[model samples]
Target: MATANTAPNPAQDTLALVGRILIAYLFIPAGIGKLMGFGGTVGYITSAGLPMPEVAAAIAIIVELGLGIALLLGFKTRWTAIVMAIFTVATALFFHKYWSAPEAMKMMQQINFNKNIAIAGGLLALAAFGPGRFSIDKR
Candidate 1:
């Protein structure tokens, strides 16, 4: 009887590592920005007219920083990726929607929205593929 190969594939490992690093790289800045109060993220959230801007900002910062670190460490990668994906989508819809913006600002809004969408796709990929053998989740 022929035995099926159970060895881990190098290419899959490479892809997972790349995905983890890439997603982590993208989120770290946003997380740090929130933590450092750069670019007025909290103020910007308030200006967006959300009911509780402080709470919203805090949640965003926590999720981005906390979940991002978890992802980079490859701990609970799939759950963290899924949470980040949802957060990304919500951020795009709430802050980056261009339709309500002044004509002059519409282009920038659209760009931001598109960028978040792209990031969300990467997170989703991580959720599906996991962090592989190079990660903390390795079997």
Candidate 2:
């Protein structure tokens, strides 16, 4: 029988740390931006045909800011990553919806849709592999 290699790789740890930071960079400012314009965000969500736009906006902020911060700090990283992965998919479906976009906007929306999927893939990887040795979760 073959055994799995359970050893830690220093290079992999460094890469994971960098990946976590890069992913946080993608979301933290977005969350902060939403908070800075709460009403505007709620309006945008309302336009998406979502129910309870205000409450949905608040939950989005919490997931983006709270989970983004958690990922940055490497706190409860696996769970945070999983949450982020789901959030990314929901946002892609609700906000992007490239298939329904008008012709000119279709390309732009499709780009965003793909971007969210890519981000979700990264988040899933983080969920599966964890935050690595440099993280608070490791301490």
Best by lDDT: 2
lDDT of every predicted structure (CA atoms): 0.85, 0.92
TM-score of 2: 0.95
For model 1, how big is the CA root-mean-square deviation? 3.6
Give the local distance difference test score of model 1.
Answer: 0.85
TM-score of each: 0.87, 0.95
State how far residue 120 of model 1 sits from its true place (Å): 0.9
State, as a TM-score between 0 and 1, how close model 1 is to the true structure: 0.87
lDDT of 2 by residue, 1-139 (tens): 1125675688878888999999999889999999999999999999999999999989988988888999998999999999999999999999998899999999999999999999999999999888988899999
Error of 2 at 119 (Å): 0.3
- Candidate 1 residue-wise lDDT, 1-139, digit = tens: 1125564488777778888888888787788889898348768987888877878988898788889888888989999999999999999999997988899999999999999999999899889767777888885
Give me the runs in candidate 1 sitting further than 4 Å from their true place: 1-8
